[model samples]
Target: MYVAVKGGETAIARSWDLLAAARRGDESVPELTLAQIRQQMRLAVARVMQEGSLYDEELAALALKQAAGDSMEAIFLLRAFRTTLPRFASSLPLDTAAMRVRRRVSGTFKDVPGGQILGPTADYTQRLLDFSLAEPSVPAQPARAAAPLPDALPCVLEVLDREGLIEADLPPAGDPDPVDLTREPLMFPAGRPARLQNLARGDEGWLLGLAYSTQRGYAESHPFAGEIRMGEVSVFVCPEELGFEIDIGEITLTECQMINQFGGSKRAPPQFTRGYGLSFGEAERKAMAMALVDRSLRAEELGEAAHAPAQQAEFALCHSDNVEASGFVQHLKLPHYVDFQAELSLIRALRAQNPQEPTHD
Candidate 1:
């Protein structure tokens, strides 16, 4: 017998209570502390911050624990938390050239102005599982200071500019302030700057998969990670009230400069072009992928064929936001019996209107 259901509110409350209990887990055992998550689950924290657009490690750790290590879910949590945070000011765009770098590397050249500092990274380590890490070990060595900075720090672009190898910067001013994508809805046929901003906050896994498709010959573009840098860049804001620029707190950032090899065009001779990428926190892979996608989106500007999905800025940027994507995707599971019934009725009507011919053996 089909019976009308009751206690929906009570059931939902009970379910939530069960979920809370599950998330907490084993009251007898010591609860996993936020510090432990921050220190141990550092990568997860980074991913959350990168996608969430909130760079707080502690909050990210909490979100990671609360989301049970689902990077996307954690990002959603962090983003929700961030939305409630009241904003006081906007920092001026950081000049990466003046960044107090902790780590820097260049694929295009052997030695850069600031010698490559291979900071805290797991890049070279063997992927073998260390079972011994089940028991914690103490470190033996203490910290030490390094050498001084050079008078000049040369970006890879500077080298090309020196030789006059690349075309001149496009007009309309290079230093124009970018629109805040978070506050506004994404419009169709987005500009390169807006497209890049969207990709920076994009879901890492989504963008990475899209980037992989390109590598496998889906709208391919030969890309080189010209440079990747991780460092603390001081933020400044010139408030009208103050009349002078104020130095705010610094942020850890990863910047990727990509060199996309583009050949002959009617406007200019064959020359290399720049694909810029920058992201919050230490996210090398995300930054590099962002750069490649950023360059791909500029196909129209470069007079190249826009055949790839990555090249479509509207598609890429509009779907990049996890908040938007998650809400839309999960909304399908919500109560929509009325809509379903309507759809079913329409389908039944369509079938009634046109009868299919029966096939004979």
Candidate 2:
């Protein structure tokens, strides 16, 4: 005799109230404003925007606040809200070459055209917590250089390409429409565009793990960070009525170019292969991880052995979404009384039939 639980509606309503109260916390502390989150917690806002596939900083800030500072929840909220918005026009492929770079670095070369600019990084900062930040105050700023950084810096990969050290970057014959993962199911043997799209919104920790696995002898990739540039890029959209591309806005972006050593194959000669990653804002870790995973997923194309989990496109793309992962993992809390009862009955009947031997205490 199975009895269904009632009062679900009332319970859910109360749960919402509880959640609201918890989110608000103590009234003594000042409530966090959306503007403060947008300005101060800019990195968090950037991550939500990037993963949520929405460029609105204000909306991302609101989502972060509503999510109680949980980035995954913020991303989910932003994504859900994005689905309700009407699509106007698709943007043209971004031009990274013309980016107004604020930070740029290369691991392969000693000196690049415009010397490496280590802008606003905590890499060299000590791990110790600063107690002074509890009562925050404006700090003196360093004087800026009179001249601005070069608008366009030469790509490190291009320098190698000139020396015939890397494979030539040739575009496909015709510009084809990219598969929209949001609307369509991600099929295996995915093209670069589809894989990149999936990786861009993929969970950071998961991607980081996969990337780390590759470095730990999972894959044989002699990879070098060719270039990593962080700055602003203009977004353009072509409306059907206008029949001309229009600059919609500018977005902060991080672009990584990874060069991997490739042995000569039957079809192609020995050359350095390329892996690319581009994301919204200054997400160097995510971008770098994406690049590593990108290269690993290209094993088939490069005629290399696909032995690692990261090398499998089906595994990588399918398990990347945090929203899906959270849902599946959390669903264990759901009632399974019927199934458990059946298992319990089966186990008891089997025990009665086959008298188990008593263990010596």
TM-score between candidate 1 and the true structure: 0.87
Q: Which residue pairs does candidate 2 place in steric collision?
A: none
Leading candidate by lDDT: 2
Q: 11-52, model 2: which lDDT tens digit per residue?
A: 979988999999999979999999999988988998898889
Against the correct fold, how does model 2 do in TM-score?
A: 0.94
Off by over 4 Å in 1: 1-7, 140-153, 167-171, 174-176, 345-361
RMSD of each: 4.4, 3.0
Per-residue alpha-carbon lDDT of candidate 1 for residues 184-254, written as tens digits (9 for 90 to 100): 76777776667877898898877887777666776668877677888788889998888899887888888
Model 1 root-mean-square deviation: 4.4
In model 2, the runs with Cα more than 4 Å from the true position are: 1-7, 139-143, 358-361
**Local distance difference test, candidate 2:** 0.88
RMSD of 2: 3.0
